[model samples]
Target: MDTWWLLAIPVIFGLGWIARGFDLKELLSESARLPRSYFNGLNFLLNEQPDRAIEAFIEVVKLDPETIELHFALGNLFRRRGEMERAIRLHRNLLERADLPVEFRDQALFALAQDYLRAGLLDRAESAFKSLADTPHADQAAGFLAEVYQLQSEWQLSIDALQRSGADTPAKSRTIAHLYCELAEAAIEHKDLKAARERLAQARAADAALLRIVQIEISIAAAEQAWARIVELADQTLAEHPEFAPQVVEAYIDAAQHVAFSAPGQRPLDTQLRSWFDASPNDALAAVIIKRLEAAGSMSAALEFARVALQRLPRLSQAHALLRLRAAMQGDGDEDLAHITQMMNGMLRSQKRHECRNCGFRAQRFFWQCPGCKQWDTLPYAASPVGP
Candidate 1:
């Protein structure tokens, strides 16, 4: 019995050794199934060497096309690194796979759309985002589609895309209004006053308090040579939107100049400007009044107005206007003084710009949408150098 027990223990030990060997072999086979580059890529990723990691992962993906997650990770990495061609190609390849799941296919399409957008291929991007409609990415895709249309200046299409988004937020409303306003401006440029008016009406309906709506209305009125309407609109703007007084006053000055020459019987713009200034006393209004006075050879009146404006606003433009009026009134006929004034005036004109309140983007003229940040109604109408 003792001898039989020793032999049984040896047999059991041999069986245990064979089982351990099988386990080790299975583990090795599993590890061997993954390409060496996969481990290297993981190491590179851990070490923060993205370039090397990308290279190593590309090898793994090339060797194993069945790696679905690897393909997605690699495609995203390419896109984020601005390698659009590679990202587009890889995502396109994923999409071409008939075996790809519906969710993955949608994801790949979205990624490809983003690639085209970043690459400035708007037409291709438009198509890709449009296909994503009604998918899980529908809402995001709709917003991106609107952006695509906006970049293409397809204002109506952008409005449609926004409508499809079905978002009722104030930002969306403002964007839609800006689109209508853009269309109105385009109509104005083509001398289609009727279309312009219709578009502005739509803009107002979208957002009554949007200052750009009033500004565009003034523009349309000016285009029609409806100087009285311009004045009326400006008066309304100053009354309702005192914060936008500078912008409204600037437009008023332009219309007032036209009225001065074209329609003399109309109430004098100068008289109206003075009245407005008396009521508001802002530097923007005061500067215009001073310029009108200077134009009429009322040098003393201009200087007096400048003195009061400087005391109130103390803005650089007002000080420059005051300097010019003082020089003209003193009759200093000094050539150097005149040259210095011209130089200072030129410097001020160059420096004075409509800076975007959102992004600080400066432009010589006003823009409803900030060129830098693309935000609507961000540029404030500050006073500019009064005269040439």
Candidate 2:
């Protein structure tokens, strides 16, 4: 029995050696079967030369028409390089193949849709995205569809697409509310106040506490001459969201003045302005209050306010305000003050730019939506406390 066991072990070893030899030969044959361009493409890709790699891969695809994944890769490369027409053609060719796998067909369709989107063919892109419904790419398709609708200014369609996207998040809610706000603004433009109110109601329902909702409501009330409602909203904004005080201050003062004219006993504009400044002290608010006093012919009050503002914040803007106030009170013969004020004004112009909170894009005027990132409610007041 021992002799038989020794002979069986050598036999097993011999068979194993022969099997390994066959595997080695098979690997070598497969390596030889791949064209040289395939290796060249891989080398170029590894070296990060995408343009040369694309040419090499194109040769490989021509030599081997059945290389499905290479076609997809080439299509993606073309699209990324802004060659949308080439990508569209390649993906369309892939979809035309009767023997293509179901998964590859879906991928080809999605790729074609993206090509159309990037090419600015909105109608074709919308149709293609709609066709992807119930497929694995449906969620992504819905998002792209909404973007298309947004670019086209089809607010209702965009809202509908966003709802179908099923991404229930705070950002999505805000985007929907902004869409409703867009509709509201349009309604207001056409003098359809009733429709504007309805759209604003929908916007509030989407985001009950959005600051922009209150702002739009103020606008609607102003249009309707509802002075009392405007005053209330302005107060609510200042008390509840003090961080946005700068943007709302002018509107609040305007509404307050209107209310005071009608009722004759509403809080004085100067008092309300001073109260807001005390809560959220900034050079802009101080400037507004000073202007109000000057408008009322209270030169003494304006000079005092400007002096107090300069003491609190020793910025060039405050100095300029004080210089102007003193000149106005003392009969305007101070050439040095005028020259200094002019120099400060030149410097302040550059600093008085509103910046986007999301992307840091600066603009001379305020924007609800950032022009850089297309984000809504991103621009805060100018970083400087005082500017035109």
**Predicted model with the maximum lDDT:** 2
lDDT per residue, candidate 1, 1-388, as tens digits?
A: 3577877998999999999999999999989899999999999999989999999999999899999899889988998898999999999999999999999999999989998998889999999999999799998899889989988889999999998885689988889999999999999899998999899989888877788888888888888788778877887777655657667787787776665434544456677676666665666677678877877888888888888887766666677777787677667676676676778778776774687887878887777788887777788765433333
After superposition on all C-alphas, the RMSD of every candidate to the true structure, in Å, is 10.1, 6.3
Candidate 1 backbone overlaps, count: 0
**lDDT against the true structure, each candidate:** 0.82, 0.84
Q: Residue 226 deviation, candidate 2, in Å?
A: 1.7
Model 2 regions more than 4 Å off: 1-67, 70-93, 96-99, 260-267, 281-284, 298-340, 343-352, 381-388
Supply candidate 2's per-residue lDDT for 356.
81
TM-score versus the correct structure, for each prediction: 0.71, 0.74
Model 2: pairs clashing at backbone N, Cα or C within 3 Å:
none
